[model samples]
Target chain A: MENGYKLSYLDNLESESIHVMREVFAEFEKPVLLYSIGKDSSVLLRLAQKAFYPGKIPFPLMHIDTSYKFVEMIDFRDKIPAKENVNLIVHKNDKYIKKRMHPSKFGMDKCCKFLKTKSLLDGLSSGGFDAALGGARREEERSRAKERIFSFRDQFGAWDPKNQRPELWSIYNARINPNESVRIFPLSNWTELDIWHYIKKENIEIVPLYFAKKRKIIRRDGLILLADQFNSPKEGEEVEEAMVRFRTLGCSPCSGAVESEADTLDKIIEEVMIAMNSERENRAIDYETDGSMEEKKKQGYF
Target chain B: MHKEKDLLRLVTAGSIDDGKSTLIGRLLYESKGIYKDQLTSIEDIAKKKGEKEIDLSLLVDGLKSEREQGITIDVAYRYFSTQKRKFIIADSPGHVQYTRNMVTAASTADLAVIIIDARKGVLEQTKRHSFIATLLDIPHILVLVNKMDLVGYSEDVYEKIKEDYLQFASRLPTHDIQIKPISALRGDMVVKKGNNMNWYDGRTFLHYLESVNIVSDRNLIDFRFPVQTVIRPNLDFRGYAGRIESGVIKVGDDIAVLPSGKKSRIKSIETYDRKLDKAFTPQSVVLTLENHIDISRGDMLIRQRNVPEIRDELEAEVCWMAEEPMEEGGEYLIKHTTNTVPVILKELRYKIDINTLHREEKKELGLNDIGRVIIKAQKPIFFDPYVRNHKTGSFIIIDELTNATVGAGIIWYPSATLPETENSQ
Candidate 1:
């Protein structure tokens, strides 16, 4: 992996991603990137920056805030606009909270739909954004493993994995009708290893939860669950002390941490490099149903 | 250090249950691409399934349902690298119903590795896959006759399948179709040359994969750069962003911008930090032009003498992928390179039969059907022929109502070639 001439796996991935981002700008009338305050989204932002170097990103950044994210992620998000000097739009499910929305009341899928998908869709409808670039990778799950670089969505933002537009060569179909927004995945071909390698190579900043930490946690369903506001354990579940770190980040209720001592990004990268289970394994919502993830995608879950 | 390994984009096709997933799994496993934890999890799953041996299929069958069903239901991509080449294999399903998946995977593939069962010599599915490989114009084709142990490693059987394939492939426009006999289950003549096929003289699967000629597969003649976006920094810098579609671009070369018909000289080509002296296909770079023009997206840059045609009407051979047949009045979003323009089907030409390579007169095309049609676009687009240059010639048709990509099209006659006649029209 000499840093010259050669297109390393990461380099090719970046090139492909940048190319896709440019296509989004070229083909769509209005495009925005869904930036979850995570490393993958950060890399996507950096790639977007590179794709339009010497100019600001043409589209604004959209973040579907669950209102239960880590404080560190929020703090970092606050400073990013000033650092990058780009437009950022934060969409929160304020209506859901006003309606006394809780995951326990309607289950994980409905909660995700309201908090994440509905918020994002509400933002898009208001802003008239036609395309939303995401940082989803196929290696995350089985149904996702068959995704194309440019994935089409219906007017309601539903995805039918069975029938997708065929993407051939460099030609990407980014066209969408009125009220229909396409979700462009720039990192569709990238794997977790590729993301880590790029993060290390580029020295990208990420949330602190990714590193090792000693926190009050509970072990249930063969997972070391992080103790967050929404995940305080049911009456029957037990709480325990565990030195755990998150492999992925989301709403604290659904996102779980694995027991590990690796605190630094390098150590975390090494652990993830050799870890056998998929990244989404620790996600509580995916396993709630047979194809809950796919079902959510059908209803416009990013 | 030895020259950095080149990228090899390959696609695998075979009949369902012909061990396509197993072969891909073995290749990735043997190449050290699968992490240790992934291997362990697969082993655990294989054990739970009560298999006598650890099933290699578990390595790639990522879907839990696909695992329970004991079949690959979708196209899964797996990447691995050796000292010589970095391989991206599209592990597509082999069932006849999933033929669309195989075609989608093979469209961008530089080569197609068609796996066949030695016990079943030259099945109908094999011909279908091979015909697709030819139609897609994959430069290299490697036919792997697997399950040789079942056939007792008989050299005559290998030759028969090879001969049958060669005879069928001869009818199609294919180049460099090589035959190899191996057992995907036994791992014979796959990653390594085995002793079972003593009389076989061809290189092993991995050896051939690493050594196959792909540099010639790219079109290096016409210089095409479709401007993706324009970059004008408030920080007092100017650059035009685009990925090189084909050929090479260098500093101080005369270039022409399409649609607007403006000419300028390339002042510099920049990546992230530094300026590049020269750039070629697939490299996304920002170019600073000698003169500032009203250039935006949907514009192309090329050498003035070797420019693509700017035309409004197009004759294209299209692969209709949507369940609903293509109609004359329906509008689609036609995407070529970085440009997306709405187009309407002007006339139905003829559909080509994949099995017999014959043209059938049809008013509409169904799913997985390839046909020639005339289309009219709202705006004139610059393009080349599908055979001459893939980057500029290829386009996708997205259904306006469903927002689904319904067809993949290749320009048969570009408007750029008939610029004078098109201008008068």
Candidate 2:
């Protein structure tokens, strides 16, 4: 494959993401990877390793534990950092946690604010990170399609979508003021299918919750939710065991599940190829309103 | 799903009225890229607006303000895959004031799909978009003479529009331009090759996108790798890490480090998976040299004999992207390849009129303005003519105060070889 070498689309996407990661490493003084312990985050972790192989990752990994995360996700997160030999910072809004902020109690909007959005901003500020890389993709949501690969945030951690800087070519402008920061999305171009394809190709390890298995679940507002310790059935709601799997990972209450029998990577890929709707359809936070994602992004939600 | 398919990046610049979004929406719909839920959401939106037929443009217009204003403001990327290739569409706004957005979309595009309303003929916006496509060095251009059903599918009308566009494009740089007539609203010659135009023999739009020859578009002759960072795990290992901007490098090949002009031999090509014998364009890999060299980020590696120009002063065509005007002789940061250095806008040569392709005398460039400017860098930069290799020849200017990327530039000539002008200071 010397003279007539042609890079497949997966290869192209991988190389592009690796290039972006390296640029962030070279440009920013303090950078951190936002790990969510989901499939996208798992793929991002592998890419980061590939990007800085022969040397350890130049930066640490940060996770905003919402306290409502799946048990398996927390279990997987506990062992990854030491195994990969990278620093891990898990930040949670202790004040809100002590107050017992739940989606059902304070509404999904306020719960997400204190748990995920506020926690993320606090984590970035405390670490004094100039750049924070996330696993957001353009195809995931409508509003996300317009985001730049290197998205800028103001001192208040607010996104000015209308006044975004123009990103030309692969030359990302990472310059920011002392308090300002840029959200780098190396996986901006990767579609959901592409992520699965890469995971299959690279044999990347992912959370076991993704594969369909026997689990306790409850039906709420037309969504199948995991029935776990953090999330329990209400007075009238019934908790039953079913073969279900999660499409996305978020707070246990906000993340939805789907009934399936795909327990392997190849089976998951087949399910995704023919699956209707979208990966984000199961995300409860996105369905708050028509432009909820846009509003959340403007408020500095990842 | 396991088949090896390449990626193609294409850009389409037009407002909703021009049927640009419809064309893209049709491509995604017919190719099975649109999921059922996405279709249902758009269908529900169309019904709420009291429309009889489903509005395809609603599928591409993702933002709320764009949907309310009926115009695209920023660039939105959409992805789709067929049997042959996977495509990334950079859909940008087409209004005159959004020239900067168009340029941003075209910078990394391999093909530009220019949608011209058949009845409107070749408008100034059409010419402007096409001119930008060529200026950004896109290898291919597909001219979709849209709204053919509105124009009665007349061959004469199609011929006249094609001729007018060809005449206007002849004055600009040459590119592989293809012309086709279709009604994006009626789905003619877009995906299904509808029976509305039996006289046309060209391939459908989707077919053209899938079959376009983009592999040869990459510059494979010049080996240039700008080191992003140096990897040193321990005392026993040291490697130079970078993505091959162009060409190929194999182990045991002679390589030269730029800026310092140091020479070394390729000792081993390393990757995360395994050791590689060689690497080609766009592959991110680590290379260890046979001899230790004092190399770091911002230094480029190239073939010894095939060297790029090392110059501190250069002339470039720039597109001002910021709201503030570009001041002549003002200092800013210029980032090229992996190097970032302070630069001064030495002179404002002339701004090009986007509509007529004519140069005008201008003291400074305002937002969305395109102009030629001479820049003087604090340190010499390795470069090539933008027409030769895009990776090595392009740069971006950052505002010193705001730290915003204010302008994107393409190198034209090194100032040392440029003829002296009377206005030169």
Q: Top TM-score: which candidate number?
A: 2
Backbone clashes in model 1: 4
lDDT of each: 0.79, 0.89
lDDT string for model 1 (B1-425, tens) is 11245778899998867777778878877876665555666667667769767777666665656667877666777777777877788877787445577778887788899989888888888888887777677788899999898999999999888898888887876477888898887889988777898898788899998888777667666899888777877646678888887888889999998888899999999887577898877788999889888887778889989978778998988888888889876788887777778898888788888777788988888888888889999999888876668788788888777667788887886534544432111
Model 2 C-alpha lDDT per residue in residues B16-103, reported as the tens digit of each score: 4888877888788777667777788878878888987887777777788878887778888999888789989998787735789999
TM-score of candidate 1 chain A against the true chain A: 0.93
TM-score of 1: 0.88
Screening candidate 1 with a backbone cut-off below 3 angstroms (N, C-alpha, C), the clashing residue pairs are A212-A263, A276-B37, A276-B38, B309-B416
TM-score of 2: 0.97
lDDT per residue (tens digit) for residues A138-207 in model 2: 9998889999999999987888878888898899888888999999999999998899999888888889
Worst 10 residues of 1 chain B by lDDT: B416-425
TM-score of each: 0.88, 0.97
**CAPRI rating of model 1:** acceptable
TM-score of chain B of each: 0.93, 0.96
Worst 10 residues of 1 chain A by lDDT: A1-10
